[model samples]
Target: MYDIKALYEATSVDDACRLLKEHPGSQVIAGGSDVLVQIREGKRAGKELVSIYMLDELRGICLDAEDNIRIGSLTSFSHITKNPIIQKYINVLGEAVDQIGGPQIRNIGTIGGNTCNGVTSADSASTLFAWDAQVEIAGEGYRRVVPINEFYIKAGTVALEEGEIQTAIIIPKKAYEGYKGHYIKYAMREAMDIATTGCSVNVKLSADKKTFEDVRIAYGVAGPIPMRVPTAENFIRGKEVNDENMEAFAEKVLEDINPRDSWRASKAFRCHIGVVMAKRACEKAVKQAGGDVDDRTEL
Candidate 1:
């Protein structure tokens, strides 16, 4: 049961910021997918909610003057899956969101909520991390953009200050250029299941598409926060995309992830699956970048 002392419908981003400032005990709600669940389960602690679901200013997918893809905080997963801009440039994001839940859940879950929930298993975080996305935040009188990887301080905790709201997510143009990415979520079931482990790989190939120019590898449910494996990425960078190098890269990834044992999966299992998922995701990304992958080869 939702025991709310008050509910304020914010008409704009400014209004939402003002409400948060005025009511320090109030929490912000857009899609309410995560918050409502938390509230019902007695996990979240606020009686007052400032609703930004109706704030049109905080919704949409567009490109800024600098060609950065800006996704409003209130943009739902449904819109994200169908948006041509997302489909064309950052379809890996679309691919991840599409697997989130049933259609109804996707229709109501916002990207902001997914990130703000700050769960290690959030399906979207690893993909966004691979793209090197930035988050735009708005407060009473100031706005700031911070890299997505830096947004999380710990599990279930975000860097948003009091009275601040995330306004949009920004993916720089440079992050998209020559990048082909893939995201994979491993769960017990196909639907309505949180990831036991997830991996996302984005690779930039050389002009000839034979060698990796830049590579990013990230994982979810692998540590205290969504993690990027720099050691594995460094090993793969400038290397030929072949069975031997890919296997070496996969082995090196074990040095980066720090998954904990949970009821759903053991730490050893998570690490083992994480390595496999990374290899598969990397192979898919390499193939998407127009490189040949040998399925017969095992990493």
Candidate 2:
């Protein structure tokens, strides 16, 4: 059981920030999906919870005047899966969040909690990394935005400050413009199982749609944080979207990922699956980008 604690329901973003500033030991809760489990298992220390579930300001999905898609931190996985804006702009993200958990978990689990939880197995992390997403943080008197790639410091840790709360996630227009992407998760079971390894690939094709103008590849459970394979991406960029080049790209992934042995899988097994998932995700992304790889030569 969780220890006794005081519960404060925050009515707005400002109220949540103020409560966090006032109570240094307090923890913020939106969906209580991750924090509650941690508290009951004695993994999280704080007993005071500042609930932001009632703060409607931190919920929704919309495009700002700047053309960046801004998703409020409290936006639930279920909402994300159904948001037309998300499906139209970055459907791969929708695909990633849709596989998070069972119906109940997805209905109440906030994207902020999943990102902030900072686990390598977080299904949303790799996709956000691939999309080059940015996180908007709010505190008592200041606000800042940072690239999602820089958000995670290590496993179960993030760059969030003492009293700052993530307000929204912003996907810059450049990240998703003319891009088609795909996400794939490998696990022992289809649902309710943590990812053994997951991969996401976003490819922006050339005008002719036969070459990869730009590519971003990210993997989950491949390291302490969501793994973005720059070496692999660099190898694939500007290359013809064919089976041979894709195989080379997948092999290059070994130069970046640093998986570890754990109860869920061995390091070697994780690395193997990471490479396999990368190739599969890239193929799917190519298909989504309106390219057919079946006609290409096998390497």
Candidate 3:
């Protein structure tokens, strides 16, 4: 049996915040995709739970006044992939979350839980970073926002306070405007296995479609936290979009990533894959942006 001291169902966002404040050691549970599994494995045994699964206020995707994409924290991966707003604006996010697991897990795994868990290998992590997403948090009497890059402190750690809950993930209009992106992941088993390495690349091409106006690239499992490769991004900006420059950009990305040795992959192997994935992702993104890239390039 699963160990639990108590369970409280929150009726709304305010109720969820109040519950967290009232129960000192309580943790919010949505979808139970990750929390329940951890509890069964004894990692979170005897934990007090604040169930937010029924809070309709915390589930949907939409655009705010500024045209920023706001995704409710409790929105599940399956919902993300099917959401028209997601498809029309940030399809890279949908594509990234789609790779989380099989149909069942996608049905229950939420974007909030995926990001809040603070794992470097979370499928959503790299794309969020590439998009320069922001985390909106709510607590007893205060609300604040943090950039996705700053939200992740390190492996298995995030900047969330003890009583705060994430409300929405915001992708600023400036971050994704005039850009298209792609995500690439390498895992032992394609379907359900955790990613050994993941890369996300986004590009904004010049009007003539001959040069990179700007570029953003990020990686998961490349270090202790999901990180952007500023060195590579800088190199690609204003450069001609051709195979020679693309290959150079890919090599420059290796200068920033710091993958480690693990059972899933070696530091060397992850580093190698990082370069390959970066190039492939960039190419796909460039093509999406109408840049001149080979149509037959193997992804």
User: What TM-score, to 2 decimals, does candidate 2 have?
Assistant: 0.96
lDDT of 2: 0.90
lDDT of 2 by residue, 94-131 (tens): 99999998999999999999999889999999999999
- C-alpha TM-score for every candidate: 0.97, 0.96, 0.97
Number of the top lDDT candidate: 3
Ranked by TM-score, the better of candidates 2 and 3 is 3
Which runs in model 1 stand beyond 4 Å of their true positions?
296-299
What's the true lDDT of residue 165 in model 3? 91
lDDT of 1 by residue, 1-299 (tens): 77667899987778888999899878888888877887888876557999999888888999999999999988999999899999899899999998898899899999999999899899999999999999999987789999998998899899998889999999999999789999999999989899999899999999988899999999999998998999999999999979788888988899989999999899999999888888888889889989988744232
Order of candidate numbers by TM-score, starting with the best: 3, 1, 2
Q: What is the C-alpha RMSD of each candidate to the true structure, in Å?
A: 1.4, 2.0, 1.1
Clash count, candidate 1 = 0
Q: In model 3, which range of ten residues has the least summed lDDT?
A: 290-299
In candidate 2, which residue ranges exceed 4 Å CA deviation?
A: 295-299
